[model samples]
Target chain A: MSGDHHGSSAISERVRHVEALLEARGLVDEGEIDRRIDEFLAGGSPANGARITARAWVDPGFRDRLLADANAAIREVGLSMAGGLQEQRLKVVANTEDEHNVVVCTLCSCYPIALLGPSPAWYKSEAYRSRVVRDPRGVLEEFGLELPAATRISVWDASAESRYLVVSRRPEGTDGMSEEELAGLVTRKGLIGTAAV
Target chain B: MPDRFAPGDAVRTSTADPTWHTRLPRYARGAVGRVVELAGHHPLADDRARGLPGTTQAVYHVRFAAADLFGDGDHAVTVELWEDYLEPADPSGGTP
Candidate 1:
């Protein structure tokens, strides 16, 4: 987090301004309803989704299914994300080798709430959101991750309809590691394209 | 021209919220762009917080060169943005 309270307040004020824009536009049916479905399900808890995703990392078949269809993969983890919206086309992309993956909705905070938890504070920042889309290499450098020139960097811009998850590479020498240990390596920022663990 | 904001327009960063919504990304504030295009608007943060079907005004994709955003990069990168996410650009606006 930045050491500047003013910086944080600026973000809050911007959020407030947007809310006012929404209200003035008569955009919502009510104040409590959630625009993003899974955001509502977590009820102030963000990491719940990440916990589910981390467990599936070690399960080979589960990982396969996840790579195949993230929506069902998450339902297996008890996500109501599949709640009624049958056409939920979610994709789980993994980062392996020297290559890495990061998700951004350069448009909005369009994260895969059904799988990963609420985006890390930095993930939603213009510092991240803009730089990741604009200067992904520079942003990744901040995380101490510099992709080899040979490695391919794929940034998935998640939208309200499309969500993405970075199935982080199980760090080197992690064989025989339990699911708990694996989870330790799956930081929220890693999922969003900032860090690996 | 309903007084709606666009992706490339100049917009100010927020410092507070009574509706308790998620905050906008930081690097975007005060940046300028052309009205690349308009994305749809969704229910606001307060509605999302209330468990109602909510959405936000996701604007257009304002294209920014990587050098402009990252400062030292010579690479090229593009940005897609929302309306409220931006306002209009400053004629002499510099980085914050």
Candidate 2:
């Protein structure tokens, strides 16, 4: 979303260099990469995660299944993550009245790209990764989420094999809202446990 | 595969270095935590990244208190770690 493409050309050029190297070795197809990029651009976004969270909020049975077997449960909603090499298995951690959960990747930005679309720049930034691990509440404060003093927080550090999703507690006074409307209230920050839905 | 630790068992992450590809974060080295759940056996990404074949290990969800890792916080951070990355947190032996 940076308006200055020129400022990012260095990073883009590095990516192109890697792509060229792989193509030269016949390890990857340029056409396939383009197609996958197109699909990701079209289908990947925080909206997919918001949809899953909304479904879980309304259907207790689905919530149970989602928490028990996230990969299988997502398929029921017509969503199957791309799995092969470098696949990420998802784990859903719920928030309750006494506890809240947040997700991070301290080593690197190992996130669920297929389900959550792409990770935010802040999520991948060194400042977020290093600070969130040491001071989660302070980091959340920067995101404008001030939890109750007594509410326990748990942070999930995602890895290459397993990614985490924080299921924010559904907001009150919207019990009668439709699923679509509820999904609209869910944001990427909420899924990451930095804000409320 | 035999499970070295079960759910709710207290365990400590090893400080050993695989000297290869690893998913274990530096922040979690030599940390004490509890096993929350079994993530089943899978090919270790550390081994897989090297183009090696047929090596696998059990993964577990381990919970470490925020205060334990960073020395000041009111939270916990749960991480999924490979089996070889953990050891029993013996009470007699000093832990980091």
Candidate 3:
């Protein structure tokens, strides 16, 4: 872990050096990088994903669209996975009575940042990446999610062009809740499939 | 190019260990899996990483049993892989 700290700072230093060079050459205007970062940060948050999930729970049609075509479905709520040069493909997997779904990027932390905000440190750590694909039940148990032995577990590795999102099953006794209130129950971990709503 | 494999087809990942960048992880290499879905065509990440003039290829969502990769689990692991990284699996190749 200590090495990670040093490694990160070294990377940051290198990035700063490159940024300074770009700014000095007038290739990039000063403060443009910060503005872009701010723009992305303003649009990225867990709330975005929560709102989408809440709509899916309350509107069956929206849920169907989300499951069928996530990239287009997100635009219904004025959201997009288009921060980069090209839009990233999104695949929404829903949890059902017979199965559970979880997402991971073993090579690197390729997450749905526009919807889920930044990934948690644990998600990017070597322990979770290496072990989850191998021992999912054990890892989920450590996360306090104890599933029945018969329940199937699906570990999605986002190693290619597509990203993944897990829609946790709606909890019981919440039919009276409104869409906004339902969104309140969603969490980053829940969207990531590490925890239930 | 047309999709070389379709959903429900059995495929095996390439075991080649290239020094260049690749999206294929080591654990899934040489593993037999079933194609679950077509993830559409996209530029190959390995060639793109190296700044090569890569062409678009079909990407498939392949599902592999955890027991096949790790030797002791009932769960499944799915990965989106480019067509170039996979080949038709031998019919006699036992369940991974």
Candidate 4:
């Protein structure tokens, strides 16, 4: 199935060729590219999303606001989806006991990069993308999540203009935990609905 | 901009030309689904991809039954699709 390594290597070479051409023509500079990389690296992480989810878990009003308008709601928490010059709208889906929610980019790796930082390699992998949509439960099991037979899964496919975030259900016995403690339990996988919180 | 379809509307995805760059997934074309959420208006990606003058189009989170999309499964696949790629499903059964 993995056709030829040379084919992919050719793609890399062509990409390098385009980059070199652009640089040679003064259309782009390595410093500008590095600065952009640094900006993206410093922009956001799963921790930011965890904090937002934690705040929502503790505050019902914020949860309502988040479900209503996610972009504005994140701004209310002092987090803005800026940088990368890409579309920034985000839609959050909450997991319930009867219905579980997961996110995938079936077309490509369209994710909430401004909220959860760069997506992990597994998320962008072809295996994850193709299998997750067809067999969500099976895929979740691979991620070590075995849902009850009665539970229904809802898979959200993100696209260019919009992104999705899965708000994992607050774990049991965490009622006494503070927002920071709760945030610590919100993994990137949990936010993506691969693993539970 | 006002949304063409509401959250609960039964709509069918249009089997539009897929030769060019489009956000509409190939698997979703001509499939019937219900609008789960109105994702607001945004620039039509189909237009943006072709380097044409872009205009806003209402987007919706359409939910398809797992069985409808992949034979059988205890799940639903919700995808964000633009307005132009969807048409109102007929009450008689088939997508017009």
Evaluated with TM-score, which candidate comes out highest?
3
Given candidate 2, what's the lDDT at residue A174? 81
- Among all candidates shown, the one with the greatest DockQ: 3
Candidate 2's residue-wise lDDT over A103-125, tens digit each? Answer: 98877787777667778888887
Model 3: per-residue Cα lDDT over A95-129, one tens digit each: 88899999999988889999999889898888888
Quote the positional error of residue A147 for candidate 2 in Å. Answer: 0.2
Q: Candidate 3 local accuracy as lDDT?
A: 0.89
DockQ for all candidate structures vs. native: 0.09, 0.74, 0.91, 0.76
Per-residue alpha-carbon lDDT of model 1 for A58-135, expressed as tens digits?
677888887776667766766645533454456667777755667777655667654565556666675676557666
TM-score of 3: 0.93
Give the per-residue Cα lDDT of candidate 4 at B2: 70
Worst 10 contiguous positions by lDDT, candidate 1 chain A? A37-46
Model 4 agreement with the true structure over A1-197: per-residue lDDT tens digits: 12222337877798788888888999998667667778877867999889989999999999999988888898888887666686478898889899999998877787887678888988888788888989999999999999999999999988557788888999999989999999999999998999886
Q: Rank order by TM-score, top first?
A: 3, 4, 2, 1
Q: Could you tell me how far off, in angstroms, the CA of residue A76 lies in candidate 2 after the best superposition?
A: 2.5
Task: Give the chain A TM-score for each candidate.
Answer: 0.71, 0.86, 0.91, 0.92
Which portions of model 4 miss their true places by more than 4 Å?
A: A1-8
Q: Which pairs of residues have clashing backbones in candidate 2?
A: none
Question: Any residue pairs clashing in model 4, and if so which?
Answer: none
Q: How much DockQ does model 3 earn?
A: 0.91
Question: Candidate 1: misplaced stretches above 4 Å?
Answer: A1-46, A82-88, B1-96
**Candidate number with the higher DockQ (2 or 4):** 4
